[model samples]
Each structure stands twice: as structure tokens, then as C-alpha cells.
Target chain A: MKPTNVRAKSLVPVARGGLLDRRSFILSGLAFSSSLAVSNAVASDKISTSKIDQSLPPWMKTPGNGDTEYGLPSKYENHIKRDVAEHTPETSIFSIWHTPIENQRGIITPNGLHFSVNHNGVPDIDPQKHKLMIHGLVDKPLTFDVESLLRYPMVSAINFLECAGNTAPNAVSLTPLDQTAQELFGQVSGAEWSGIPLKHILQEAGLKPTAKWVIVEGADGGSHARSIPISKLLDDAIIALYQNGERLRPSQGYPMRLFVPGWEGNANVKWLHRLEVTDKPAFTKDESGLYSDILDDGKIQRFSFHMDVKSVITRPSGKQVLPEKKGFYEISGLAWSGYGKIKQVEVSADGGKTWAIAHLDQPVLSKSLTRFYIPWQWNGNSTMLLSRATDEFGRVQPTRAHWRDKYASYSFNHYNAIQAWHISSDGVVENSYA
Target chain B: MPSRFLYPRCLKFMLSCLLLVTALGQVAAYADDATYTTDLGVALSPSEVSPYEITIFPSGKNLPEGKGSVKQGEGLYQNHCMMCHGEEGDEGPAARLKGSDGWFSFSDPLRVLRIDKYPILLISVGSLWPYATSIFDYIRRAMPHYAPKSLSNDEVYALTAYILYLNDLLAKESVLNEETILDISMPGKQRSVSAWPEIEL
Candidate 1:
């Protein structure tokens, strides 16, 4: 029922046995589709060269467009937006807006599309009055205003931040009709952050040998705070002042935020204002009551900071209608690990019957999103597609069954399982469990 | 192969080392004098901290001087918290505080595995909260949705005691103070698990 003329022509037959050639199959397939579009228009309209209007279109008929001080994405890309979902029905005070991962490209998430999770609500902060206070178990307690913090030496790091509650919906039930890749797993985002490292500030304050944890608090209505170990802060944490070469957006913690690389999104305290160095962890409400995961044995797992290895095929993902069945398509997805870099991503087109190594995009950095792609020729058969990622530490993404066995089904945090997308015979892709 | 450039290179390297040593001596002398230059942040004084800088740790080390009885807390609850948290703290808009059935059990078993039967079905301040100190900190910092940080220290203590009493964790006649509040053991803390599974690659 689907057109195979383009693919049939591209393959050269052998004399002894009929075998299809593989060279430039993807390239030629794309070219054939474009040519087919033009041929269809010509055949339907019967318009020749003499009757065609050669003048440029209305906008291009005039002079070239003038430049603006600030540039925005093309008008055609208006559909790309951060999708907001209300987590609490009592009020929109606590809400989550997810990044459109299905529509994004490369590793870095744009400033506007960065995911936002707010407790109480996003606070309108005046940077002029904002100051960061560093005290408790330090030789010299220090306070730095916005201008003073800017004077300190700064560093830039590209890392990913994922919410621990990302796969909460998937763990319960996954339906293709409603949820897409972005809707299910869009709580994670990557950014190139620029700021002074917390270690440099700690060194200036002179840390007491007894200092073990640093309680970072926000300036929001909740005064949301979390205690992180001193070693994690000293290792890679930064007081991020800018994101993606611009001062942070209000929802992303305007003026400043504490960026704890490779940790859960909540640990990166937004609207950061205070850092109290202490000998013990501050078992805050968010850490103990909300984010902490309870096991099947009735014991709680505390401070599970790092996310596990995970990958999801974004292209050919849920809700996407394939243009044609039996057409050549390229499967692309995102892979990330909180522990380290993603070493390899293996994609299966037949529900894990067989897997082929997907090509990793260049410049794969640790604790950042890595893009991977593979070309496949659809057989017009209803099949499932899955991507499994192995991190540098050799930790492979596990199945939902294995994960649920270890942790309780009600345990909603820190869920990282291999996602599968089903392709129907009618050329419709959907979210499915393989 | 050329001796001419080698001698000059050696001399330059030696001279650089000598200058480095001299510079190191000056830095050491400055350290001995307790004088240093590392531009960073401004030193903060205790008085400079904001009025809302109170954070109670798990050890109950930062509990302010305040005392309130369960009788005193009931009035505050009716006036401020009852509208959203419901009567008896179990029925509310946010989270339930007093329900005991299947509290800690999330799965179908509907029973907790722990030996100590402390009902923790709902994630409320009383049942699931690990630390007793979090109650005071959370209430003081964020409560009474319309007007936060409006409660006095004594009112916060009273409200905390009333919620604990409603959960059957505290006695109706008990008055909670800085010292007495620490002695109130939270059931969630007893069942807390510290170790994480070693996830090998």
C-alpha cells in the first residue's frame, strides 16, 4: 500500500542473487521524497515553465529583512514551547513545566525551554537586595552581593539536571494517545552554566575541618533548602549566575542558583541565598518526606543523588505519524547519565530481538546529554523500537520489571528504565512497553 | 647537537628557578605576617543575617526558646490551619495528618514490614517526616498559605504540638518547649535506611 519505487530503484541487483545495495540508502531516500513532491505538483496541476511566475514571493519581493538587536527562532518554530503541567490541583502554586525534548536538537536546552519546577511559586527577586551568605563552621563567615560575586573568578560547565519524579507517570501507566517522549521524560534538561565554583568561595571563607555538609537555602516563599555533602560541593558544584550566556530566567532562578552537577534537580537550590556549613545533614522536608524513596522492606533510601543510565528514542517516538510505511527512516534519541558519560547507545527495531550500535554524536561530555542516531529501513510490519544506553561506568539501563522488583511500585523517585515505542502497520508510532 | 643554545637554556632555567624561590620566600614571609590577598567575598557578621534565617537541624540544636500547650495549639489551628488542613488534621487540601490505615504501605499488601507499628500512610508532617525539628522549621518558614512567616515562635510551637497530639504521637496535656520537643521521637526516623545499593557498572 506504501510507495517502494524510490527504494526499489536505489538498490542495485546482483547477477547471481538479487541483493539490495546499502550505499547512500538514507541519502537517496530523502532526495527521492523531495523529487516526488515536486513531480506530484507538476503532474496534478499540469503547469509548465512559461506560465510560472518567476518573481520572488511577497516578502522576498521587497528588500532583504533588517536585523534586530536580539534574534529569535524562526516564525515557523512557534509550536516549540515548554509544556506546563499542574502537579497539584489544590493550586498552581506548585507546578512543573517540562522542556519539549521531542522538538529540541543537540545537547544544550535553550534558555526558554529549560524545565521549571516551582514549590509555592516563582518569586520575583530584586538582584539589588539579594546577597549570598556563607556561614556556620567557617573561619570567616562571608556575604557576597551580586556585584561582589561577579568579581570572583568564574567557570563554565555543561551538565544535565533531571527531576527525580520524571518517570512517575510511566511507572504507573503509559499510554500512547496522550503522552509523548517530551511529556513523559521532559523533566531533564542540559545547559552551559557560568558561575563561580562553590569550592572557590568555600576556600575564601576558610572551611573548618569539621564541616561535612552545606545547607543551601532558596529565597522563595517556602525558603526551600537542602543539605548537600561538602565533598559533592567541593567537587563540581557552582553558584550559577548565568545560563546559556544570559542572566538566568526568573523561573530558572533569576540572579543566582546553586548548580550541583549530575544531581537531582531539587538539590540545585534555586533563588539561592544562604549556605550554612555544618557537621550533619539537615534532613529537610523535601529530602525526607517528599523526594526520599521508600523500599519494599519499609526502609527509606535517603540522599540517592545520582540518576542512573537512561536513554529514550525521541524521533519516531510516541504520537508521531510516519509519512509512509516501508520508508527509510533515521532513529535518533538522547542518552544521559548522572554518574558519568554515555559510552554507547544500542537501538533495537524489533523489540530487543536484535540491536545495532547507534552512532554517538561528537563531543560527548560527562554528565551531559549525548545525541545518538541510527538509520533503518522499515519493513511495513508492526514492530517496537527501543534504545538502551550504557554509561562510562558500564551501568546499562535496566527493564521496568527489574527496577520494580528492587524498589516498590509506589516508590516514584529515581526511575530510569528503557523506554519502547511501538510502530503500527498504519505508520503510527506510539508509547509502548516491550 | 649545538652546545651554544644548551648553555643559555640551562642558565635561563636556573635563573628562573632562583627567581621562583625568591618569590616563594616573599609569599611565605607574607603568610607568617598573616597578610594575604585573595579577592572574593565580604565577611558576614551575625547581626547581618536576615530575621528569617532560622533553620532547625535534625539534632534540635536550633530550636528557639518557645513553649506552648496542646490546649493553646487547638485555638491556633481553628483560626489559621483548620480551613485547609481540615478538622482533626486528617482532612485537608494539602496532605492528611492523622489517617492510620495503610499509612506507610504503598503497595497492595497494605501493611508495613517494620516491627514498630507507627502508621505512616500519608506523607504528612507527623507521620512520614523523619526529623521532629522539620515541623518547627517548615511551619515557621512556610505555612498559612495566605500569610507565611506570620506566626510567632510560641504559636508555631503550639501548632506543632497540636498536630503531633492529633497523630497520637504526643500527649494531650504535654507542653512542647525547646528541650521537650527534641524528646518527641518521630516514627519515620526509626525506620530510616542509610545504605544505598552498590550499583556496579
Candidate 2:
């Protein structure tokens, strides 16, 4: 049996009268024998709850007072915390620590707890001194300070930005026993972003006839520049200044950033400083030799930027061990597509052999995160779990091998394969490769 | 017959001359209406027309001259890139560049959902990118982040050659300079189609 202290630390007490609390209590009591000791050392050591307090203040402590300047998730009202794992100055890439998505309820990823992927170290950019310049192939090159950008009409959308290399480790044949959901898929989260339309700025600048591409450069030390096609700029691109309905976080391109809808997160250049319209693409390292993919056919694939449709069963995923019962369990997760809105998400308990349609929460916005749920009853047998998503455009999620044949596995930008989770008889769920 | 007919013809000619003068006056007035400014001198040459300008299209045009063998690139990759990008461009805790199952579907729903099907803005050497000029320009500007823009034109070309060779796009003996680099065709070029038409508001 697991230690009593370990179990106590791992489990958060449920409100006695609440519906979920009663369910959780009943479930906990029944599964107590099989429940392993919550490894506090592993959990606490890996995740620093201190970062959570940095984003929250004292006055908002009470539930009704709503201490969050930005709101905390309702279900996880008390689990608010920053997701920083370790900070290093060298590559500027900080760990989001590791938060199990299986434990999360509802869709709004908490601001402090949102996963972070920084290329160059995060810059302490002062909004007072920050400015966005629109130059290059334009009749008039104009610069907008943060104040001026705020004056323009603002729009908001609940969207998710995921690093292209979010799940590169899952490609490894060896299952990473030490891996957490945050490490496997923590690089993604959805937030309400508010910003000005990129097209509005381009129209104001009066794009010249020769302009073919706009090169967006970040102010970070890496300067992190990439050439975005002119068409995407005019579509739904925005110069987002606010995330989760407030000023952008420092780690997430504070002051200002480019929100390239439906494209790779990196292309949505964070800490945006300059938009140079040019007659040709700016061969920035991030776009050419770096972001470009070398395919299997002895040819390099360049500028292939749109992220495809994908879905993951957040609950019953990595790290979370389930109960050894034959009763119904609520399987829920988030699904999204860069192409368009996710029309439907189907969950398959027996791998891809059979699938059952899952329910999606309403207000399905385009290029936004959509929550999905299905009540699953386990029969006390080991099973291969999978979920497939179909976007509005009729694009279905492909198998791992199908994607590998097109673009060799060398490039890590678009790895939207059907993910699988293995359920042992003991109910310990693990990351599995089928 | 003479004098009376000649008098009428002279009157018609005189009226025609007056009309021609008025037209000329209007033309002169139009020219004088426009004013010229001397504050800004002659128009500057377009940046694209500069001598150092190098741009490559998908069809391999406008490539500069220079040659870099794979053997030469191997040395440069070893000395500079081996530590971070990996010895064979596959090593790195940061992001690996080799041995990916290119189009393999990930079993993870997050991974599957995030993979782009027709990724038109690829940042790799194999897909979506239309030009090789970017390869030279990018390597010349920011690469080996520890030592930014440290490689010479030849070394950049050599590194480009080595990377292309590793991807199996370039022959081992082939030399890559500004000139020949664009000549080598990338395989995933066909996959990168034109962008979708913008919806008119």
C-alpha cells in the first residue's frame, strides 16, 4: 500500500456537497487500495508553485473576490500557479515545469500556468519604449508606439498557440518514463487574445505594388525574424497586445506580438518590433535553413507553414493512473485545427478498430481550442486509446506512418499523428507508441 | 473669279490660326500648373537593384557564382554546428534536424492536431520554401547563434552543401556557391502550393 502521507498530499479535498466532490469521494474511496502514494518529491521538485503567486495578488485570494486580474479556472479554483520549470539564460528556453493536463478541468489555460516556449531569453521590454515599425515595400513607412497601436480598433478571439516541436520526444521509440503531460503536450494552451488587425496596419501603410512578403522581426536578442506571405497578413492576422483579456505577459511577448491565425506559433512572432514589407521573402534563418523541412525524397520543403488538425485525450493520458473498476469514466480533452474549426472528434478505445463520436462544447470558433468529452466504461482490460479529429475542411487526422512518408521525420514542425495511450490492467496510463 | 473667293479663304485660314493658338495656350497652362520640388534630390535606386543583391526563385534563377564541396562543408559543420545542431544535424536537446519520420502521424492527440497538412510556410530545408537565396542569406545573417554570421560566403555555401547532401538533394561531389546553390532543386517544392485567395471584405 502507498504511504498515507503521500496519498494525502497528492489528493486535493473535494467540497462535500458539490456534485463532482461527491463523485470524487466515492471514486477515491473505491480506488484507495490501488492508489499509489503521490510522489510529492517528484511533483514538488519538478514544479515550483512560487511562479503562480507572482501572477496573483493577495486581495483576490477569496473565491468570490476573484483575486485574479485575469480569472483563474473555475474547476481548478485553487490550483492557480505559474508553470515555469527551470530558467536558463543560455538558450533562453525555460521549462514550463510539468503540469498534468489529465488533472485539469475546463478549457481556459490559466495565464500563469500556461506553457512557455522562449527561443532567446525573455526580454524585459518596457512598454513605454516599445514601438512597432512598418516599413520596406510601402508607399509610406509608419511606426506605431504601443500607445498608438492601442488607439486602433481592437478584436478578441480565444485561441491556442503551440510550439511546432511540442511533442518531439514522443517520436522516440523508448517511452520516456520520467515524462509528464506538460513535457509531452504542455507547449499548448488557449487564451483570449485581444489585438489590432494586421490588415488595418498594412492598409494604413499603403502597401506598394511590388510588396510580396512581410518580414516580422522580434526585439529579443535572437531578433527571431520570419517572412510571412502577404496573403496571410491580409486574412486574419493581428498584432495582439493582450492575452486572456489583459496586457500580454512578459514571457509571452509582452507589450506587443504578431498573432498569425492558423499558422505555426513561431510565425506569430513574439515581442514584435518591425514589419518590413519587401518585394521578396526575407531569407531569415528561422524561415529558411532552420524552419524549412528536408523531405524524404532528397528534396527540401520550404515555407510549408500551416498546422494541421489534431486532438488529444487530456484525461487518461500520461502520468494519471485510473481506478481498477468496470464503471463509467468521463474522458475529456481539448481538440483544435489550424485549417479551420474542428467539426467533430471521435474517440477510439480499441486503437482505430472502432470509434465513437464525442461531444464538443459549443461556441466553436475558428482556429480556436474546442473542448471534447465522452463517457467511457473500461472493462478491466488493457486497451490502446486513440482520438481522431475531423476539421471543417474534411481533413482527418492521419496515422504516424502516413505523415512520415511525405515529410521525413527529420523536420519537427508538423508532427500531427494520431496519439495513443496504453491502459494497463492495473489502470496505470502511460505514453505509448503504436 | 479671283479676289472675292480668295478673300473668303483667307478669313477661314485666319480663324483656324486663332483656334490653334488657343489650344497651344491651354497646353502651356497645363504644364505651368505643376510645380517641382528640389528638397529631395533624385529618386534612390531600389534596394533590389543593388549589386550585392541575391534572390533565388523556386525555379533556380539569379543564383551567384561560388563552389563548396560536401567535404569542405563537413569540416565547417564539425567545427561550428556539431555541438548544438548535432554532428549529423540530428543531435540536440533543443530541436533535432535529422531522422524524423517526416509524415508519420503521432499517437498523441495534441501532436496529431498540431501537425500541418499543407504547411506552406515551412522553416525547413526540404519543404514550402521557394528559394535557395534564403539559405545563403539566413546562414550569412544568423546561424551558429553562439557565433552569429561567423561563416564566410564559402563556408556558408559549404554548410549549405553539406546540409543539402545530408538531405540527399545534392550530390557529394557537387559544389554549392551562390551560383550553383539555386541550381539544385529541392524535393518538397511541389508540395508548397500558392496561398489561398483572400476573402474580399
Candidate 3:
């Protein structure tokens, strides 16, 4: 039989029946296992931190290996990696690898760990062989090789790409897994993308007045396609050539991908090879049916492109245990809005009864991640921690009760409700809706 | 359908226009360089773009010449599909693709229901998709699960017809072509609404 629970005794005990007594009954053997490690660290404070090393550290004594053509992260950082999930383990082509946001710090996610949602897996594309085609309702069809696109004047912006289907498990009525913030909300990632404006090429092709939408198709095996309004194309859209200052990663659409700032990630088509101008939205399978949100009302919300304002605390989240029963800990998390810059993010340690203003990191860029934090003091009592973010346009992240009020019987996609992580008296944190 | 204006790149024409544009700054990254080089891309004839032009829209544009019926699709389904999608496409080890039992017939998850596992919505045609073109378009792009884009145009049309027939939208004797597929009015067609249509940007 499979057992989901295992108990661990708290080394430091608080008052009786506070929360430490209940932490032993929590889900997962991982928390029980980590409690032992936490106990060990407490027993050997100075020695655990390497102050009393038996010998000189191997890396300090020996010279490091020769340089590489391309650098990789240190072996110690191997544990920090994306959590992958497929439609099924049998079919490898369709999958998504969530970024390990809990193990990460700072605003920008590294290129390697950047969250990925590949419908046809990563395609092996040769830059030399790849060419971008612009046709359909244009005055004339045009084809530009990679070299030609590189020569065009380019623009760069730091933006976050959040999948429309991101963060529903914890945000909605879906069975919340004993998961980290990375597993739940890691579908959102920020990157510095550099590329030519899409309109630059469409202008060369000469958009006909009849052109109201642009159907961007990828070169992946599925030829995954989605339709975008022509107005957004002329606004801040780009055919991205580089990601985080390097030739685009193969998984991130090697030669090029369409980048629509402040919009849903699928609309920013990756592995882009063609842009067909049309009079209306293509009603593609992904957009019309898949990405579209099903509301509580009888109507299904299609073409809901703007990602709502959302935030989540990465540390002190599910599975991670606090080392102390009573102590001061800086609560930190990432926040972003597809609508505009985050105006403010408020934190409430005691559920929603009272609130404290969290500090927003300076120079908040629109559509990019904004890290928020506040000094939190634990009082050895079980309590619920919550956070809410407001954007420049004044759209605040709604509560779980508010979110469910609007969504349907089985609505799953576009879930960005305010997260509630319950902190036990023993310092174990878990996802809590009650 | 030929357009009116044909712009050719010239250094002299660009240099003169460049001076006038410098006086007025830009809002976003883009400024209309060409009165529309400002033509770096090579112009292509219709045939050159034809090889990659398999995309089909709601308007039934770009569908290749082919025809298929439910009978042909039945044989093809057993050979290529049936394993993951199952005998009726509803008894799935994969996605449920047969039935469209109106709305809200599936299980709701997590909280109030205490769903022991992650909820996977089993969406089928007529319930999920609004346009019939999307079914044919999706199958042409991705299908048979293991080997994608390996099916013939006739096979794609056949499968499209079969799936539609299974959903009770098409008759058992129905044959689908580019024109006939567009004529299908999916039950879920008008069910979709924009959550926030006022945000025009």
C-alpha cells in the first residue's frame, strides 16, 4: 500500500496543540525527511556551515578543469532544475517543463531553466536553412532568410511569458499537489528578447487594408499556430531572434519566434516560420478551444489574451520547512501583470483579516516580473499567509472565493487567484484553501 | 489578386526620408521606414510560398484538393489511432474525442470535491472547438499520435468526417471536402465570449 504521510517530532516545541502537534500529520514523506536534516543543522551549527572542515576543500586545493566552448552551471547547482510533465510519459513530444522558481532568486529566469511548453517538443532547426515567410493578405508575399532578419534594426525588452493554462492547480478547485511555487506557477518566466518588429517585415510585404489578424505558424512538427490582432502586431510585437543575449535556444524557437508583449504566451508563437495576414482570427485549435477560458456563465471566454495580475510566495511555500518555531524571516515572491507595471503588492500573514504593504522593487517594467517582499515575524502559531498584487491599470489579483465565483463547473485555465500557504506551528508550510 | 503599390529599395530615396523622420521621435520601437528597406526581404511568387502554404482558416482558405468519407476514416482510425484514443474515442487512455454531452457534464475538481488527483478535462469536438476547420487543420498538423503529418489529405478528411460523425454532427454517409467542412456549424461555435472585450489593445 502507498502511504502519503510520515511524522517527524519537532526539536523545538512551542505551546501545546499550537501547530507543531499537527505538522506531524501533514502530507508527503519529504517534509518528515527534511525535519531530520533541520534537526541535524541545529545540533551542529558551526560544523554544518564548513567552519570545521576535516581537510582543505577539493576545489580550493586542485586547479579547475579547462574552459568549455559553452559554459554550464556548476555541478552543485544541478539540483535546481525544471519539473517536467508530459501529456503522458509514453508520448514525449507533447510536454511542459516548469521553471524551479522556489530554487531561484532575482527577476530574470536563466535561459536554461526558463519555463517551456512545447506541444511538439523541441525541433532541430538550422539557422542557415530556416527562412521566415510573410504572405496571405499582404500586397506581395516575402521571404527573409535569417541573415537578412539579423540586419534589420532590432528592439529589445525584458518581459514575462505566462501560459494561459498556468497556475490552476493551486489557484482553483483542482487537487493541489504537495508542490512548490515552481511546480504550480513556474509557467511564467521573464527574459530579455531581442528581435525586429513584426510590422517591419509586414510593411515590406505591404499589409492590405483587409488584414485584421495575423496567423503566426511555427516550424515545429505540429506547425503550432495562433492568431493575433493586426493592431497588436503594429504595437509592440516582434519576431524574436535572440533570447537573453544569445541566438535563441532551440527549445525557445531557434531561428525566430513571434514575441507579443503583455499578451498570452501561446499567442507569442515559437519556432516561427510563417505569418499569414487575414481579415479575421483563424480560430485555430489552440486559441479557439484550448487557451480559451470556460466561465461560470454558460459562455466560454475566447480571445481573453491579456494575462491577469498575479503573485505567489516562492519560499516558505509547500514542502519547505522553516528551521525555527519563532523567528524573523523575510517573505519574498515574484509578481507580474500582463496589463501593466505592478503598482503595489500587499501581504497578509493572518489570512485576509489584516494587511501590510509589501515593498516593490524599483524600476518596475511593464509586463516584466517585479519581486516583492516584507519582513515577517513568526510567533510559533499556525496561520495562513496570503499576497495580492495590483497593476497600473488597477486590476488586482482576486481571492480564491472571488475567482471561483466567476469561473465554471470545471474551469481550469488562466487560474491566477491570490495564493494561500498555511504555516504550521512546527514551521511546515502547505497549500490551504480553508 | 495583385496589389497597387510596389516599393523598391533605393539608397537615395531612404537617405532623404531619413532626414525628415529625425525631426520627429518615435513612441514604440517601430517607425514606418518604408512609405513602406526600409525592403530587406526578398519578394516571392505565389508558387514559392505554396509548398509551406498548408494553413486552413475559418474562411476555408488554403485547404488542399482532397475528399474523404466516414467509411475510409473507420479503416484508417483502426490502423493509426484506436490505441490511445480507444475503440469509441471516449474510452481513452488518452483524450476523450467522441461525445459532446452539452455543457458542464464533466467532473469539477480539487477543493469542494476533494478530487484525489489533478483534473484532466476530457474535451471533445462540438464542445471544445467552434470551427470545423480547426478539426481538419489540427489533424493535418498533428495526428496518429506517434507519427504526425504522415497522413494523406484524403485520410485527414476521412478522419475529420468520422470524428464529426461520431459526435452525431455528420451522417455516416457524409463525405467531406474543403467546401463541405466549412459548411458545418459546430454546436459550440457561438458559445465563446470574450471576458474583457473592452480592452481593445
- Best DockQ goes to which candidate? 3
Per-residue lDDT tens digits for candidate 3, residues B1-201, read: 122334456656876666667656633333424333245677888889888877777788888889999999988988988886767765444455665422333442222221222133334555768888888988888886677899999999999999888888899999999889988988777776765453221
lDDT of 2 by residue, B48-105 (tens): 2343233333334444456678899889888877775656554343333333323332
lDDT, residue A55, candidate 1: 79
RMSD for all candidates, in order, please: 9.7, 18.5, 10.4
Task: Judge candidate 1 against the unseen true structure and give its global Cα lDDT, from 0 to 1.
Answer: 0.77
Candidate 1 chain A — worst ten consecutive residues by lDDT sum?
Answer: A13-22
Q: Per-residue lDDT for B117 in model 2? A: 23
Per-chain TM-score (chain B), model 2: 0.55
Each model's TM-score?
A: 0.82, 0.64, 0.83
Candidate 2 lDDT, A43-121, residue by residue in tens: 3446555545655676576556437664545765666443444322334222343344555666677677666666666
How well does candidate 1 match the true structure in TM-score terms?
A: 0.82
Please compute DockQ, using alpha carbons, for every candidate against the native two-chain complex. Answer: 0.28, 0.09, 0.34
- Model 1: docking quality category: acceptable
Q: Where does candidate 2 stray beyond 4 Å?
A: A1-100, A171-178, A409-411, B1-201
Question: Which pairs clash inside model 1?
Answer: B103-B120, B103-B121, B104-B120, B104-B121
Could you give candidate 1's per-residue lDDT for residues A6-38 as a string of tens digits? 443454421111112334343445665666543
- How far residue A222's Cα lies from its native spot in candidate 3, in Å, is 0.5
